[model samples]
Target chain A: MSIDPGMLLAIAMMSAVTYFTRLAGFLLASRLSLRGRARAAIDAIPPAVLFALIAPVVLTHGWPETLAAAAAGIAALRLPLLGVIAIGIAAVVILRALF
Target chain B: MTVQSEYQSSTADEIRQGLADIAPVLVAMVPIGLLFGAICTTKGWAASDVWLMSTLVFSGGAEFAAIGLWKWPIPYLALFVSTALVSARHILMGVSLAPKMHAFKGWRLWAAAWFMTDEAWALGERRARRQTITVAYWFFMAVPVHLVWVASTVTGSMVGPMLGDPAAIGLDFAFTALFIGLIAGFWKGATTAWVLVASGGASALVALTIGEPWNVLAGAAAGIVAAWFTATEPDEPESSSPEGHLL
Candidate 1:
């Protein structure tokens, strides 16, 4: 099948945008100085951003996802990383089977 | 200068050790990458398109958002904007990692940034917290994940439909599981708990209402706000930018 040149252009643009953001850190850090609260905010970012991403999925996806996310979140607190993932995936599979 | 030379002169064993460190994350990424490929085919995207996006964009969240918004007429402006917004997190990721990578120079530094993913950044941060991370370690850790990701995309786009509905087998949850595992590593203290609740709540609210990538942005903003309001004893922050290290 023939490829759409427009779509190809879109993909290229998307890639460029993504790369710019990835490279932005080093570029910005040189020009700007972050100290005190600003630095604290950056430190706080990863977990907060991750939570934001996961929350919508769990809240909107119904009980199976919620229950599984709960199991995973709880397991994450106590178990090893891989074990957390295992229990989460297992919970989802089993929940789907039962419900 | 010495550290730069040391990392630059890293032995093969160090590189291989880097690969070993990221092995588990790579295994988890398999299902998600394949799902992305399958989703691309389902959306009527060309195989070339899938290959280009996966190899170039290399972000599951952005690609997924772009595909979700794709239409027949093709909303080029909207697609570009939303994908950028979804990937905005990488900007912060870049900042968090820049200190450790200050020792790198030229193409080596650029390559490290190019391969930076949420998983890679988190793993790199964990390593940097414990010990210095070298270019060799970063390369080995990142390159294998990138290769596996691209290959998985190609395989899924071609063979994904044959596997039937991925959702049926709970394979769709892999991305969620992946994020959860990564977040688990970042959970630091009560501050983390407050930030997570604030961010997650904001994200869920935005998702239910606006229903797009804005949720992440809003959630992040809310979390930052919460961080500002929450008080804790004065302590040295984990890591800081190389204000002095930058040249």
Candidate 2:
């Protein structure tokens, strides 16, 4: 594929912004000691952020896909990490093919 | 002890420790990285580009998002905005590491920032809560994950397309199962569970209406706000705790 200047620029910007976000805490936490409500807010941030990241992917694909994925996940939960992953892949592919 | 001696000993120890600590997560990351490499290759990125992303960006979610958004012809500003929004958790990771990292300087801080992934952050928080800020400890926690991440991408770039349909061999399941496993591991209490459910519900609701990237942002915002409000207390004393606990 031909590389577009715009795409490269976007990728560069995305990289910069991502780096900035990652470094923000390191920069800010030391300078501004969080206390009281701010501390509470900080503590809650991670779970919220993580949930935000994971939830959409499951939902956007719809219930059938999500449910299939979840089922695969559930089955894999007790197995080794590799085992679980295998199950999930099989479920997605097989279900897709079946329907 | 001499400064050089101390530095050498610490670095050696850290590399050893970092590998050990990250072993379990690395196992999971390998497959995911491979999947990412494969997907990127399939999407037409060069092998070098795949490795470059893993080396530089080092963020699974953001990298994936970047690839997904590439087709949009979105402006760099929008891409950056989206990435920042997605990676907002890194800010939280940095905040939690503050007290432990008070003494780090210059390149050390920057290196830490660059390697501060979800797994690394989780491990670092656990170590920090115990008040262990040894450079070795952090290094031990970061390096292996980073190496595996880079290597896996390279592997995926080469092997992913060759594998053809990842679903054919069931490799595709690794992503969803791993995430589900993580959710199970992380859902400690009622509040956390609700936060996830609410976030999922909100994202789904928004997605059904708005679609595409907006769903990701809207869902994330809803979750963050919900968790912020429903949180039990501030100064809850770092979730990592000092007991080597896995919360």
Model 1 ranges off by over 4 Å: A30-35, B1-13, B235-247
What is the C-alpha lDDT profile of model 2 across A1-99, one tens digit per residue?
355565566666666777887788898875545554455445444555545555555666655467666775586447644555556666766666776
Q: Assess every candidate by TM-score.
A: 0.88, 0.72
Top TM-score prediction, candidate number: 1
Could you give the interface RMSD of candidate 1 in angstroms? 2.5
Tens digits of lDDT, candidate 1, B166-197: 67777777667767877877766777778888
Q: DockQ winner among the candidates?
A: 1
Give a tens-digit lDDT track for model 1, residues A16-76.
9998998998676634545556656666777777778888877787888889998988887
Record all residue pairs in model 1 with backbone atoms less than 3 Å apart, i.e. clashing.
none
Residue B227 miss distance in model 2 (angstroms): 3.5
TM-score of chain A of each: 0.78, 0.57
